[model samples]
Target chain A: AQSVTQLDSHVSVSEGTPVLLRCNYSSSYSPSLFWYVQHPNKGLQLLLKYTSAATLVKGINGFEAEFKKSETSFHLTKPSAHMSDAAEYFCVVSDDRAAGNKLTFGGGTRVLVKP
Target chain B: SQTIHQWPATLVQPVGSPLSLECTVEGTSNPNLYWYRQAAGRGLQLLFYSVGIGQISSEVPQNLSASRPQDRQFILSSKKLLLSDSGFYLCAWVPTYQETQYFGPGTRLLVL
Candidate 1:
């Protein structure tokens, strides 16, 4: 079984300031982790993923996440927050037992960017 | 560029009414297709996935059924829909391996 827990249900940050969204996971296998963003009335978009690669993974829109194996965590971060960054963020874990890569998503965190 | 489309950005149906939602992907062949439902302020719940035409894998047990008549076309249907069937439905696709899955705009279904 694989599961993800987003530490924050909501996060607020001032524009131009740094942003951090925390996530923790539990998986029997090595685990593949992912972060996705969903703007209002839009579908989810992939931000980054950790698939047994380097600890630090860079993604689109000036975002990145560090996969800390020892901590069982993958936290998303950005140096500067933009107004456009206001959206819902989800952390995901894949169950290796499922062949089609069945994903288990976090409840999601709503990010509010204050200007 | 590959793109996926789901019909009727929004829908309102009565209970026990037959339901049909279609999804199609362009610029790709034999791609993996998936259908997911999202509750209000919650994560996605995968319903069905298809790897090829006429082959569908169900992830959840519900009145919903899926069909893949074409290599890139997937459809979700039910003989009758329940009031609990209403939610935001999304269709997605991925090439293979751990490639990122791309989602459609999503269909907001409200059953009354």
Candidate 2:
């Protein structure tokens, strides 16, 4: 079984400051992880994915995440936060062994950016 | 490039009414389709998935059902709408051999 846990339900950061959203996962097989962002009334957009290629992955909108195997974590980080960054983020895990490419989603972390 | 489309961007229906939301994919064939619902302030819940025409797998037991009539067409339907069924519904598709799923704009349903 594969599952993901987003440690923070909410994260508040000031514009121009760094932002971090934490996520942890458990999977029996080699897992694929993804980070998606959803703006209000908008569909979820893929930010980045880790498929055992590299530990550090960079994505759109200046977002990046590091996959730490020892910690079982894939935390999203940004050097600077923008007002447009206010949205809900989800961490998802998928086990290739699972049928239908089913994904296990985290509870999600709502980000609030204050200028 | 593949694109997923979900119709009726927003809908308001009375309780006990029938519901039908359509999803279609472009630029892909025999891809896997999925339906997901997101309740307010919550994460997404996988409802149904289709690997091919006439083949569907349901993840959760609810007042909802899904069907795939065509290679690119997937539909979410209900015999009767319930208050609990109201939420944002998302349609997604992935390549047959790929793990990444792309999402549609989504439909907002409100059961009154």
Best by DockQ: 2
Error of 1 at A30 (Å): 1.9
Off by over 4 Å in 2: none
For model 2, the local distance difference test gives 0.95
Cα lDDT of model 1 by residue, A1-115, tens digit: 7888999999999999999999999999888888999998788898988888799999999999999989999999999999999999999987656777678889899999999
For candidate 2 chain A, which ten residues in a row score worst on lDDT? A93-102
**Top candidate, metric lDDT:** 2
lDDT of 2 by residue, B1-112 (tens): 7888899999999999999999999998899999999998889999999999999999989889999999999999999999999999999999979999899999999999
| Per-residue lDDT over A4-97 for candidate 2, one digit per residue giving the tens place of the 0 to 100 score | 9999999999999999999999999889999999999888999999999999999999999999999999999999999999999999999988
* Cα TM-score of candidate 2: 0.99
Please give the C-alpha DockQ score of model 2: 0.90
Candidates, DockQ: 0.68, 0.90
